[model samples]
Target: MAFKVAIFDWDGTLVDSVEHIAESLHQAATELGFPALERNAYRNIIGLGMVEALDMLYPGLSREQMTSIREGYARYFFAKATMPQNVFAGMADVLADLRTGGRGCAVATGKSRRGLEKALLTSELGQHFDLTRCADETRSKPDPAMLAEIVAFYGIEPHEAVMIGDTVYDMDMAQRLGMPAIGVEWGVHDREALGQFSPRAVVGSVKDLRFALGI
Candidate 1:
């Protein structure tokens, strides 16, 4: 059956923002007198919301410390707004094509509602999506809540939607909801790593992703 809705992950999947993410995370740690994490350490938690990501990175921190670090990270991240955070090549056209083909596009991201809104505005890609859900508004990835909500909102069955993301969280979430998933390689995770979740296809480029989605 043709996919009626296409749910996407925002950060590493659609936009190239890992460097900025890592920089902000490192800054947050250092500003709090904590040891700075390596770039890969930050990348490993790219698909989680800020709170969850901080929790994993600095386990055992007090709630107050977590709050402070989260604030600092947001400050550092948005301060670098001038830095270029570009969409993957061909994604704009592909999104338009999908819409033209009668497929509704939506975002299911680990970003906070405010962060995702800013991204959508800055990227000018907000018009492409029919619906969006953030980690703060729903359970984070691998929970299936976000996708389940999107499917329900569209009045479509689980199999009528496809999840496209770069992490195992995305694939596992979709699988749990009985939806098909496609993995893109250009994100934080590698193909081999994402493959462990058994995505329908692990695509290396946006071009390949278009083919996988048949858009």
Candidate 2:
């Protein structure tokens, strides 16, 4: 069946925020006197929720410490007012094409509700998505709850939706729901890593992604 909904992952998938995210994680760990993770280590956990990512980065932390780290990460990430998070090239056009094609567009991201909302406002891309589900509000990526909820909200079956993301977590989540998933190369994980989840297509550029989504 033709896809009726296109669900995207925010950070590395739609926007080029990997450096900011890695920096935030490093800064958060440093401020807390915790061992700072390497850039690649931070990148590995990009698709996880803040709480989950912190736990993986600094195990055996108390609840208070976790909260502090989360706050510190947010502070560092959003501190530079001039730093603009740019959407992937041609992605705006992809969203517009999807909209014009009568397909619903939405976000299923590991970011907190507040973070996602801030990004939408900052990027001025909120108008493109019909709905958004954040990790903090529901189960994070790798869990099917977020996708399941999105599909239900749109009154569509899982098969009618396609997940476009750059992580194995995103692909796995869609797989759990029996939904098709398309992987993007410009994100956290490489094509080989994402391929383990058996994505329908692993696109290397926004142009290929547009074709993959049939937009």
Candidate 3:
């Protein structure tokens, strides 16, 4: 409740796009002649940048293969209609309330610039954020660099901002900066996986998340 800035993750934290993302990745993998794994495999890599995620999924891939995956994934992702309804229930209201209360709201996401732009356009919730940093623009998650950039933009200290995300990457990024993080359970990881990072809290639902934010 003492936080001045609220930074959120895009995919599972803000939107219910987990299944859609996993399916798209699988489609892209199949298109590239790569062996498509289970949805959970894709889920584990959800919060990472595309290239980073692919590397984790299929290590030692050729650069050409990486490019193909990227293009193919983007194509498949956009082919599925992502509408404003994809946003998690009450998430839009939370963002609006944060902005209305003069709290800085930002996004530190693994989504590419183009991907985030497309999502923002479709969702129409982009205006709620004061700033957004895409993985393509900075170091990806599990690294604290992008979060550092976000806090620096608002001229606030790390402790003044709270990161709300669903993955260990988010928790790890916040921990590296000695910042507070609230892990949402509905995303990639379960409560047990998220607790290993010693987050401020691990919430199970939107109501719980709101209480953590005091919004």
Clashing pairs in 3: none
Per-candidate total of colliding backbone pairs: 0, 0, 0
lDDT of 1 by residue, 1-215 (tens): 36889999998888888888988899888988998877898888988877788888989999899999989988988875422248877888888999999899999999999888888888878999999999999998789999999999999999999999988888888899999999998888888988888878999988789889987
What digit string (tens of lDDT, one per residue) describes model 3 on residues 1-215? Answer: 79999999999999989998999899988987999797899999998988899999999999999999888888889886668889988899999988888898999999999989889878988889889999999998998999999999999999999999999999999999999999999889999999999999999988998899997
Q: Estimate the TM-score for candidate 2.
A: 0.96
| Deviation from native of the Cα of residue 95 in model 3, angstroms | 0.8
Better of 2 and 3 by lDDT: 3
When sorted by lDDT, best at the front, the candidate numbers are: 3, 2, 1
lDDT of each: 0.88, 0.88, 0.92
Give the per-residue lDDT of model 2 (tens digit) for 163-185: 99998899999999999999999
RMSD of each: 1.4, 1.4, 0.9
User: Global lDDT for candidate 3?
Assistant: 0.92
Q: Ten consecutive residues with minimal summed lDDT in candidate 3?
A: 75-84
lDDT of 1: 0.88
> How large an RMSD does model 3 have?
0.9
State residue 133's C-alpha deviation in candidate 2, in Å. 0.3
Q: Output the better candidate (1/3) by lDDT.
A: 3
TM-score of each model, in listed order:
0.96, 0.96, 0.98
